[model samples]
Target: MMSNQNSVQSGFLPIPSIRRTVSPSQALSRSLATALVLALLIFVLGPLVVLVLWAFAGEWFYPSLIPQKFSLSWWSTVLSDSHFGHSVLLSFIFAPVVTILSACICLPAAYAFSRYQFPGRRAMFIGIFATNAFPKMGLYIAIAGILYATHLMDTFWGVIVIQLMNTVVVMTWIPAAAFSAVPKSLEEAARDVGAGPFRTFWHVTLPMARPGIIVAMIQAFLASFDEAQGTFLVGAPNYITMPVQMYSMVTNYPQQAAAVYSILLSMPSLILLLLIRKYIVGGYLAAGFRMK
Candidate 1:
């Protein structure tokens, strides 16, 4: 009986040893994962962090691990400059207009694409996606010619129009996913409750799609705000944008220009992103849940 008990005890002893062995392996995996994530974060964000530091640094060129001094002189200089002020004002005005226009143009198309089985729908989507594959620079000549012909060249409207073309595709794709998440049964229930198409859309559909719409707006706004090539191509000489102004200043006043303009330009998108991050995450989760 003592031998039998000893055998059972010995068998149970390995269990703890097995657990101890597995724990290290699991810990190693978790450690590796954490290390990988940290590495990636540093890799991606290191440059931006450096840029921000450089912007604030009083003087930085070579052989400097850190700045000797820090001051707001750059900010003061850029803000006081008329050219920077004009460019910032122009960007602030143009970005929202482009976003709104893109949303207006895309919403209907997105609705049709998501809810209906129209002819050549997939093909049409493919075509739209193909546009992104092409180098946008290739189309600049054509765009410039059209803008010149329409007498919109070197105007704010020209930049808006150019941004609109790209924004619509993004805005539509985002909303279409949101729209598709709305159950057919819900629409039928609204109809059964004596709700017309517009009423159902306004009351039921729009609320559910709000997150996606916000995300689309954020995307469109960022696209419009950061647009350099198209704006430069179209609005050169006559109208100056923030990016254009930044480019011009880079040669003469790299530090001050990068410091002030980069912060100013990045602030809106960063604020917007922070504001809607939760909604964007929730929308994506809701989309996945609806799909299942």
Candidate 2:
């Protein structure tokens, strides 16, 4: 106590320089990590940035980093084209139809897999999981051959079937997880409180699983709308959609027109993604794989 009174007290630490500082290696590593993330984002978004630039570039040349002139002529040409309009119409029609059908067919199946026990259930789940584990091009080819034999190839319905095939795995796997994640006790509580099975499910179960279902639906819609390889193989000459049309534009139309079309093609998915961004995270969709 006597020494304490005689001690030299400072208002701040003498080593203030080192107080909030990281070691050199940590700082370097943090800087490098930030740089790598920026590089990766640039790598991914670089082409998209160029597309936006090229869409408005009227007189870009090899030496120019930016366009020498800018104009809205490309947007006009793309918007005015009959083929672009038709492709848009077909995409809007087909994507929604595929999403609805997938929900109807797969949502019940997901619920069954989640809530019921049956013989061969595990094996059936594995089979469904494995459908998306392989490269889809080979499957598309096999399906195309089958479609040809079945007299379904090159038809609108055939195209729908092809797109729907892509969606089955997503719809089943994600919603299965979502449905399985719902607490059994809450469902039971609903039933015990005079709720019927359907009412219990509609009120208690469905709301809890809605995020996963929405994620599944969004994935299905985008898969159908953006699918090019299957659509190309099955519906090329007869039912050319937006993605398939992009192939033609790349080879035939000016870069600017293709850029404008690319932006337009991307708008719907982007808009939807922005609106319901929360549901698209992996947690809602991937937390349900331990079904016994």
Candidate 3:
């Protein structure tokens, strides 16, 4: 024992060195993963790269690696267009309104789903998401007749209500998970100090769940802003949002206008994503199921 202790003190302990070989299946999986990553990058980014090139191309024909010429003329033309400006204004106006209204309706419903065990709760939850399970275009076609009968077609509120359906499920579902992650102990602690139910929930539970709520609202805003089918079906030829404008430009073969509109439609959501990236980690989301 003394000699062993002396050997250990002298840093002479025998530690086995193990060299592991990669199995054939592991090697194949690694190769496939690399290929899949490269494929996905090209698939997603290829169109975006082409869009930027087309936006600046003065006159690039086929069979060319790069544009023959490039200019800022398209930018000037798109910026000066009054119709594009109107669509931009309408998108900015309605997306937030839809988000706010959705959030208001979702908040209480989310709380109930999170904290309660009422009858038909599971069915209602499943049914809410079932609306999103089907094809949205078919749903929009059905809703169009209702909008016409209700005299809501081609109106601002009509367009908003159409947009609202796209966001309602997402807003409620995300925030319900968020609210579920909040500790009941924290609410009880707040109440122990004399806070009422409303006060405790407002001061304690809400602040804890705020990050998720913000994320949900941002997603809701983006959904409403980018919803093409419903907005186009309900509000087109009268109230055109940015996504509908992009659709029209693409259909009309105005490549530069389409590219510029695409950029305008995408930039805000990208900026918001960058700003809230820290709150969007998988661990934060997984906390919904990690009940204390």
Candidate 4:
């Protein structure tokens, strides 16, 4: 009876768990990864840190780990500049316009590439990407000359046209891949249920590919938002976007002004990414692309 009772008690007792130890290889790999991450953070953030310091610093000089004095005068100056406000407005206007137009142009092209096979298809994609292969300066100069000849120089429409160069090829490439990854059977299933091509695409394929399309549009907007050289050359002295304005400010104004502009340029993208982080992650996953 005692043995039986003891056995019963033992059955109810919990077992002690064994802890897993890190292997030497795993430990080494972990150390290397941590070091690499730290290195990357420092490399990228060091200059940005300095820029921030300069933005608020009054009389910062050498050999100081921190600024001597901080002031909001630079911030005030940047805020008061009407040209800066205009630049921000222009970016807000042009970035979305560019994104919309690029989507319209790319969606059909991407669908065609993914849905059909034709001669020189691969060559055509290569040609599209090849346009960006040239140095940006040379490309911008060529584009600017065309804009000037067409009398589109210094116009909003002209800038929008030039911004297409930033978006079209890449957006098409991504959506094409995403579309190819989607199974054709799904579309056929939709059709068998009496749905037309447009309805099938709208109801079936588009939702499946929404993640990739969202990512492509976001990328296109960012490309236009950060576009400097092409916009500066094509829309100079008339319609300056935020990036072009910042490029000029960085060269001629104090570091503080550059810092202010940097923050302004970055805020919209950061906010946008935060809002659609799930879509970005989903897009990468749906496209079978690894984040790292």
Candidate 5:
């Protein structure tokens, strides 16, 4: 017995004592923090777990924590739906088109915000930000009224305009901060060496800001891609995008089909986020206030 104990003790590291010198307050704080994190995990991930189960469940019922059987029929049904392909096409078209348009409009605004000092500059920035900071349902309703007047209702441009609204704030703010971070001296040095203002900006300033711009573009794409509420209000009958299709599936289709569809809707945004995960850091975002 002594030999076995000695061998085991020598082979493996010793375990620490269960008793610790931690203060009562510290112990309470640690326990509270752990509980909070656990709660947050449940809040965020619990539905996802349920959704994933429902997507594959063959005969799940009440009073059960798991399915009786699992199959790929849910996925097959979701994939086979005629509207599925159309919804995906609409999402792809809308997200990228809106992203491109947003980049064109907001990038120049971002550059101006970073480089120029004009009247109402801060106010303009605030106004742009306030569009997103406040509740959007009201804005969508108001915009719907205007669209009705302009005969833009149920039109492609109308839907594009709505999705574009969500992208504006992130697209402008991040790139503005990025452009502000580019050293003025480098741009000046390029100009001094015979580069024109535009050339200098292209070569020196823009490349340095590419990371933040990439991050912004990804955000804009996701925002437009995931947008369902406004799209539903305007484009329901004619232009049902993927997210909007999810809304329809929730009420009209089987819960399992909806689960399968939800995961499909989420794939592009998840893939994009994972691809650009490194660039979506807080460093560039924190530079927003540094923009003058």
Candidate 6:
């Protein structure tokens, strides 16, 4: 009887041992997952942290993980200067203009591409995408010559026109995806309810595409805001944008340039990204909704 009792006790003890064994494994898995997340965070945010550090550093020669001293002198200098102010104002003005122009031009084009089966739709998309392959610098001379001939060279409108062409491509792709995500059934239902084609589109189609449109607008705005080569190549003498101003400042005030303009340049993008991050992700996932 005692031997049988001992055997039963042993079995119960083994069950506890098995439970104890799982605890360590679970703990180890949690630790590994934490480590992996930390690694990814460092990989993504490390450069941005370093950039922020360097921007505030009194001098930017490497050899130290941290700056010896920090100061707001550079920020002060940038804010006090009228030139920086003007450049900032220019960026704010032109970025919106570019965004608006891109939206106006791309909306109809995106609608057509998404809704209609045109003869050369595929070819047209291919041709448009092909333009991205050529280096921007390669087109500079030709663009400059054309602008000069058209009396738009060295003017604000010239920069706007040039930037508009590039911005429209990106803007169109986002909204086209958004538009394509809208349900055909929705339009059909609207039509069945006695709505005209224009009324159905205005009421049913556009509201669904709003998230994508917002994302596209933000993208186009950032593109024009940070544009360096096109703005430098086309904008001349007195027509200066923030990036151009920052470039010029690099020669004379490298630390100040990095500190002030880099921070300023990043703000619009950062704010917009934070605001629309959810919408962008939602739009991407909801792209399959059109099939319904």
Give all TM-scores, in the order shown: 0.87, 0.91, 0.86, 0.83, 0.86, 0.82
Q: Which stretches of candidate 4 lie over 4 Å from their true place?
A: 1-29, 276-292
The candidates, ranked best first by lDDT, are: 5, 2, 3, 4, 6, 1
For model 5, state the Cα shift of residue 227 in Å: 0.9
Instruction: Choose the strongest candidate by TM-score.
Output: 2
lDDT of 2 by residue, 1-292 (tens): 7545433332244354353354576789999999999999999999899899999989899888899999999998999999988999999999999999999999998999999999988898888877787689998998989999999999999999999998998899888998888999999999999999999999999999998898889989999999999999999898999999999999998899999999999999999887668776557655644444
Per-residue alpha-carbon lDDT of model 5 for 145-241, expressed as tens digits?
9999998888899999999999998899999989988999998899889999999988899999999999899989999999998998888689999
Q: Name the TM-score of candidate 4.
A: 0.83
* Predicted candidate 4 versus true structure: per-residue lDDT over 87-139, tens digit per residue: 98998899999999999988898888888888988777677777668888898
For model 3, give the RMSD to the true fold.
6.3
TM-score, structure 6 vs. true: 0.82
- 2 or 6, which is superior by TM-score? 2
Better of 1 and 4 by lDDT: 4
> CA shift at 225, candidate 3, in angstroms?
0.5
State the lDDT at 193 in candidate 5: 93
Q: Per-residue lDDT for 184 in model 3?
A: 90
Sliding window of 10 residues with minimal summed lDDT for model 2: 5-14
Once fitted onto the true fold, the runs of candidate 3 whose alpha carbons sit more than 4 angstroms away are 1-33, 283-292
**79-170, model 3: which lDDT tens digit per residue?**
88898889999999999999999988987998899999999998888878777887899988888999999999999999998999988777
Predict model 3's lDDT versus the native.
0.83
| lDDT values, one for every candidate | 0.79, 0.88, 0.83, 0.82, 0.89, 0.80
Lowest lDDT 10-residue stretch of candidate 5: 13-22
